[model samples]
Target: MDMGGLQIEQDGQTLRILLSGVWGLPSAAGLDRRIAAIHAGGVRHAVIDTSGLERLDTAGAVLLHRLWRRLAAQGAKVEWPAPRPEYRTLFDYVADSGEGKVIRPPKESGALALVAWVGWLTLFFLREARRFIAFIGRVAESAAKVALQPRRLRLTSMVHHMEEAGLRAIPIVGLLSFLIGVVMAYQGADQLRRFGAEIFVVDLIGISVLRELGVLLTAILIAGRSGSAFTAQIGTMKVNEEIAAMRILGLDPVEILVLPRMFALILTMPLLTFYADIMGLFGGAIMAWSSLNIDLNLFAQRLQDAVSLKTFFVGLVKAPVFAALIGMVGCYEGLRVKQDAASVGRLTTRSVVQSIFLVIVVDALFSIMFSIMGI
Candidate 1:
């Protein structure tokens, strides 16, 4: 029931603050107001006498700490002459833990803030590019070593990742690719019907799906799924210091972790792409039959004429390259992860985004190269 209060008295150049009553949560509001009303502008020395305090808790301890800092900042040298044994530990904890510090926001940078931000971003990009190049070199060197001694390849880990990244991805990839095919056919038929060439919808679906969408969509799915998984798994290991332990024991973390996932993706991506192509074609053919009244035979026959071996191989060749990018980026970000749970999540998201972006870029480059080559 006792309200906390402080009485300040000044004598010449010195100030004294004597605290009394129950200094707890219930009295925190009154104490704060009272402290705020004090004027310590030019006092050279101040003594805080806590002997009159009837009770104290963490909340009151924090307020006392705040008051002490406020007076010090106002040009007064503050001192707590003799804190009681019961309050010493709490007061020491509050002071040492910086419970009274105020965090100020950064000053405004005005109109030039955008330019400064752009410059900082450019620098960050260049630095990350250098690190990525170095990471790729290390991966290539490790790959060459494994290629020389095939026995060093960890087949167990490779198989596990293959099942994870490839076999298990079949359902979602197949379903989505099939749906993409259906939508593409339906739209193509609607457009071609205007020109009295609904039958050409077969050519549209076959060439597009076999040559582009099937592999591209499948790679995107894998990047979001398997690529992010790689980052999270390895980042978590790094956070737990498991990666460091591997190095300490003379084991290569790159060889043991990165190479296996990389090789698994390289081996499985092409096969998954092929599966996606078949599923896509099947969906397109079904829609073609339903919408354009084209039978399975006619659809298949036209598909053969529209999509050649070159077309299929063109898309197929890009699968390994895309897989390598996804695997390398994912593992690279994972290895770069700092020792924290938050870093794992952040780097995992970065891995997925970077992998997808690089995949799309590489696909575009491939398209340009194939065009120039007249294939």
Candidate 2:
């Protein structure tokens, strides 16, 4: 039915409205109210029949847009036909979904979007990794030059590192390992004694200590001790501009600073682990002898029999890798410092954390790889 130059028709779920006379604020305002009423009545879907619209203006366009928005927001479906040339120009400012217009897409790019996002992330990760690799390569090259010309990496630094990683760590590593052994021995004894298999405590302590605990305990100790020390020393040097001074003097800081630490760490970590294994074994022996009444000689024999050179060497080999990783991480963090004391401290802590985390991750990788190799 026609009502004041506007035609309105309701067909089931659709309410079609048409504008005829010169469109203005009056037409838009009336439709806004009517759309609100329709929404209130839960008439969710409708078509606007603009077939009769003539001489539409800004107000006419705003009125149509307002109804379109209200219908959309109320979960009402609305389809307005391709506007007549006269009316279409008025709604040209409409963009995006909130314009209260129904747009049917010819195609969707959801899959393509996901692929692009994932590809970007992958490239980002690879770029970061490549940067790290490049950094390592530069450090190594600088170190090689220093080694060739300056004659660094002498016995003194190596000896000192051995003293620190091995001799200095011995007491704590030994004590901890011994205690771990003792606990293992007691636990094994309590259960094994029932089956007259108390001797297996020796095997348990030997295998566990040699293969896993010794390496792990040693790594944790060094991470706490040497890892932090590496970071702090390099960080302090960095903060003091000593590293920059070396660079100015044409001295490769990596060789003078980092290479020594690398040598020291690689030199001592295995020794520390070896010492730890011994200590853990001794502790286990003590527990076995005291709690299980197992013969010390028998425990030693069982330990020797149960722990193979292969297993012992495995832990030994892993220690150098752990040390290298720790040193790398520590040096990386230290180098990142921009001379701030707070940043130095923060970087030191991060170095230790990252070192320990990488040690575990590398350990897991080693375990999996070795298992595959039947090690």
Candidate 3:
């Protein structure tokens, strides 16, 4: 007997097949050719001898089962004679399990199925919205409780989160804002130079950064950084049953965990926006001096005459609202995590995406409001 090789002998109306050696995945290659050869032999009956089989795994059993089935289907009788216990067990298991089973075709779906899917999604969205509103209400109630009883507030935890989310983020925020300012100044300089209005690059950079880009970009970065971190941290706690334990101990997880993050972001975001504005202006000044050949003093004087304090206030005003949205979405998604590792990853990603989306939407709303008010 050869490894993974079959020997066939024909005697009158009977056929004898000998299977030998290893017949697992690695050795089962070319098995289809052997099965085809047997099928083309025109034998009416066959005996599968497994006595020479040195090693037989599930794959070998499946191949053997398929050969037996094909022979049986072709009006040939197939028998296994005195198989070893292990071989008999493997063969019988594979045969009973119906490996290489026939596949049923999928049922066709029409307009009714499409309508059902749409209805299901709409209901799911409504249910999620209800839960989110309830979560927001709980967060607000917790904040009110903290406000009334200052002792219940976790000052140390709040400070720690503020440092983590706000202080640590300053370097990146400043760098990105600086680069954006430089790019804006460069582009504005080039365009305005065509009309001999290079000095107005200062106004372009100051007004754009202060009124919109600085705060919006800073919020987006925070959503991806701190927002994702909040979701992952809380989601991990949920997975570990720590949140449930807090409830068992009569402690509010929202008050203890979520409140501190929300408050810290609310307090720190405006400060970060201010810092971003200054850095962006500084970067724009440098680019103005170098690229547009506008003196730093001239750029400053032009900025003073063109951009007002109201423009700066308008950008900083959006910071706290964006921060609250980011915090709520992050904590909400975190708390929604199921008791699984995959759920933590999925919810964390959702938190970042949802937070960023809400921040942009709120920014747009503010823009519309300010436009209406003629700011």
**Tens digits of lDDT, candidate 3, 89-133:** 998898788688796778658887899999999999799889989
Give the per-residue lDDT digits (tens) of candidate 2, residues 117-176: 999999996985686577678767866776687755556776776677668888888888
* Deviation (Å) of 242 in candidate 3: 0.8
Sliding window of 10 residues with minimal summed lDDT for model 1: 100-109
What TM-score, to 2 decimals, does candidate 3 have? 0.73
- RMSD, one per candidate, in order: 10.4, 10.9, 9.5
Best by TM-score: 1
Model 2 lDDT on a 0 to 1 scale: 0.78
Instruction: Pick out the ten consecutive residues of candidate 2 with the lowest summed lDDT.
Output: 92-101
Q: How many collisions per candidate?
A: 0, 2, 0
Model 3 residue 311 lDDT score: 92
Query: Among these predicted structures, which one has the highest lDDT?
Result: 1
lDDT of each: 0.93, 0.78, 0.90
Order the candidates by lDDT, highest first. 1, 3, 2
Q: Which has the better TM-score: candidate 1, or candidate 3?
A: 1
lDDT of 3: 0.90
The CA lDDT at 221 in model 2 is 85
Clashing pairs in 2: 44-76, 177-280
